[model samples]
Target: MAARRADLRSALPGLRRTLRYLRPHLRPERWLLAGGFGCLLAEVAFRLIEPWPLKYVIDAVIEPGAADRSGIVALLLLCAVALVAAAGLRALSAYLMTVCFALAGTRAMTAVRADVFAHVQRLSLRFHGSTKTGDLLTRLVGDVGRLQEVAVTAALPLLGNVVALLGMTAVMVVLDWRLALIVVAAFPVFVLASSRSSRKITSAARLQRRREGELAGTAGETLGAITVVQAYSLERILQRVFGADNQRALRDGVKASRLAAGLERKTDLLVGVATAAVLLVGGTRVLDGALTPGELVVFVSYLKGAFKPMRDLAKYTGRLAKAAASGERIVDLLETVPDITDAPHARPAPRFRGELRFEQVDLDYGTGERALRDVSLRIPAGCRVGLVGPSGSGKSTLAALVLRLYDPTGGAVTIDGHDLRDLTLASVRGQVAVVLQESVLFATSVRENIRYGRPDATDAEVEAAARVAHADEFVRRLEYGYDTVLGERGTGLSGGQRQRVAVARAVLRDARIVVLDEAATGLDRESSAAVRDAIRALTRGRTTLVISHVPEEVADCDVVVRLEAGRVVEYRPRALPRRGETVDARRR
Candidate 1:
């Protein structure tokens, strides 16, 4: 018993947190909830009145000669009216309760889902790289959805049932104290039974929820990488994995179901025994002239009404357990603090000249291997520099530092003499733009994809940027022109076309600092030429840092920094002519 109490105490915080999600939404719907509760009270009052009319009818029948035949007829009519009125009020109250709670629950869950999504987006790349997308999706969508069910479907009805049970119990006691005592005695037994089974039900439910998460993860991972799966003929292996997870979920679900069914049956048996005992004791009193038959009939009706909530509560035990598990998972997620957040005193950065400097910067990926060690470099305002290196040579890491994707472990990166850490993350990131090798595009219209970089860009501006990137011709030839919707990740477009769109986006951003991380590395010859033309347009007046393995791609840059094994091995400065000089003269 002590252990059970301790467990319940531990569970309360999770329940409280889950309920907190509803508080903000409930304020606006307070009146609706109050009205629903008022209706519930009226329904209970009607139910109590209902049994009295039946009692009058029974009394009228028992003593026909005590009153006129018309009196009996009137009593019977009253009974029928009371029954109909109670039924109508109950239906009305139930409808109000369902609608009010459903609305509030839906709004609360929607807000929570949006917050979780925003939080996920704000989390660092390290968190995302380590966490599975499938697991996060399950938490964001599935777990949140289950919480809604608990708040709306199970919780509302449970509340109403509890009120009804208490009301019915009071009415039963008033009708006949002796019979009420017999009914009340069974309450503790029910409580004990429920308590004993609760821990087991909760454990099973938690296991089932975990299995469900695994199943969702397996499905998402498999489908997300379907192309790779098929190319490698991993269909059978993935199928086997999915099947195993599905079977475990199924087994756990069945176990939870069985426990719930057993709990409900036990409740039924206990209620049945109590009802029989009440009938036996009350019938004897009625026969002995100590109680009227009409009173005994009322007692039986009240008894059933009072125990209905107990039975319903028993049935809902499994659902509540599952909801509790989901709630715990949600709380765990919401409680996680983001690894990277702006300091309290951080200020927005002003427009920069884009002089970037890394002073004794060090980066350790927490894997015992240092990615960058005491590396320092400087790029003057509006200067174009090429970062050349073999694979795993910290070239991309340097670019990431410029974007503030990950802060250096041991040193500071400054932009125009302002430390990156002291500047607001948003302000710093807004001034820098990147065009990666694999450009990511949403499943949207071409015009919208271009406008994503600058949401308020006009149609003319978008078109001009696309033309500069040489993507306007193909876009115009599409079925819907700029409004043509692409598939996920721009699936319908070739790699070159995608790269051009990305370039158009970067052109639209018009940031001061631009990083090209192997942007033209994977393009075919014709595509490469088009993209190179676009790059030339993009870097016309920007501070550009080009990371590449190809020497020719960096040949025109004024300076080149080459790194090997996390150390700068070479720094070469070319005597190139100033901007606007002829290409031949600059080369000379």
Candidate 2:
């Protein structure tokens, strides 16, 4: 009991911090909150009046010679009507309160979910590579949604009940201080029981939430790689692993339930004990001519009403604890500062002239392995460079720097004399286009997929880009032509077709610089020839970086650079072509 005040003192700061974090979302709903609170107060008032009708009904029957026959009948009718009216108003207030708060909570949570999603997308790739997709999805979808559910149903209703309890207690005190003190004295005992269990319940709930995230992550990971699992015949093994984690999560959930149930039963017993004492003391006082029967009835009714908050506390404590756990997880994710953000004084980059230079750059991926060692290179505007090396020789990592997908751990990458970090990310990425080996396509029409390169492109522009990539012929042969909807990850298309579509996207971008990271690595001979022709069209007059192992592709470049163990081993610059001489002519 002595520790109760200290516990509350410690909890108050955490409560204030939570409210501070929520201020942005809650500020817009001030009016709705006002309406809800007003209804809540009205509900409490009606509840206080609810017991008076019964008191008057009892007193009228007990009191001798209180009024004449007609007078008594009118009084009885008035009490009955008042009783029904109070109940109706109270019901109306409760309904309005629930609606108003529910609307507020829903709108706030919806906004929170959107903000979390946008922030997560903006976070750097390093953050994503380390975190599980299913864990993020859980926090963004399930955890935030749980907070909304609890706020509207459990938390808001509990607030109303607490108010009602306070109002009822005030009336009880006015009726008879002795009985009021008796009911109030039970509070310390109630607090003692709940304070110890609250921490245990919250801890249990937090552990359970973590377990659930792991369970979801395992399931999502296994399902995502079903082909690999099947190829390896690992279904039963993986299922057993998932089942064990699932069982662990179940045990955690049950532990929380048991703790909450134990607290609630203790509260129920306390309520019963307090009520018995109230009845005994009040009845004795009445027998001694110290209290009237109507007043005694009022005290008994108030006793029941006053104990309600305690009963509700027992009912909602565990649920609220879990909700609190979910809330903390969301806050942690929202608080994660992105590893990369524009500097305070950074401005939108101007149109790049495509002159790129890497100045003794070094990159260490936080692991022991250094991705790139003190590498220095220069490529003039409109130059095509071929990068070749063994696997993990930092080919893609170097291209990533030009896009500022990552910053160098040691030195800087610059375009046209400006460090990439000095410019905004959107501006840098906007002027650079990329065609990866396995480009992803959404379940949308062929036209929409091409338009993803430039969202505002017209149909004519999209078709022109497709023609340049040699994709127009095959795309036209499809049943829906440009309107044909592809399956997830472009399942309906052949590998060469998908590659051509990606090239079409890059063509539509019309950026000053392009990176083809083995874009034609997996194509057959005929497909490779068509794609090379398309690449020639795309890279003409643009600064291009091609990461490939094909000798013929490397032969077409103006410069060939090779890396050995993340260090440049060979740098050879070939002479420029003669006037009006195409790359194919030079090759022949």
Off-target runs (Cα >4 Å) in candidate 2 are 1-16, 65-70, 476-481, 577-588
What does candidate 1's lDDT look like per residue over 274-324, in tens digits? Answer: 999998999898888877888888888888888877777678778878888
TM-score to native of every candidate shown: 0.93, 0.93
Off by over 4 Å in 1: 1-11, 64-67, 576-588
The TM-score of candidate 2 is: 0.93
Task: Please give the CA lDDT of all the candidate structures.
Answer: 0.83, 0.85
lDDT of 2 by residue, 269-338 (tens): 9989998998999999888878888888888888888877777767776777777778888888888888
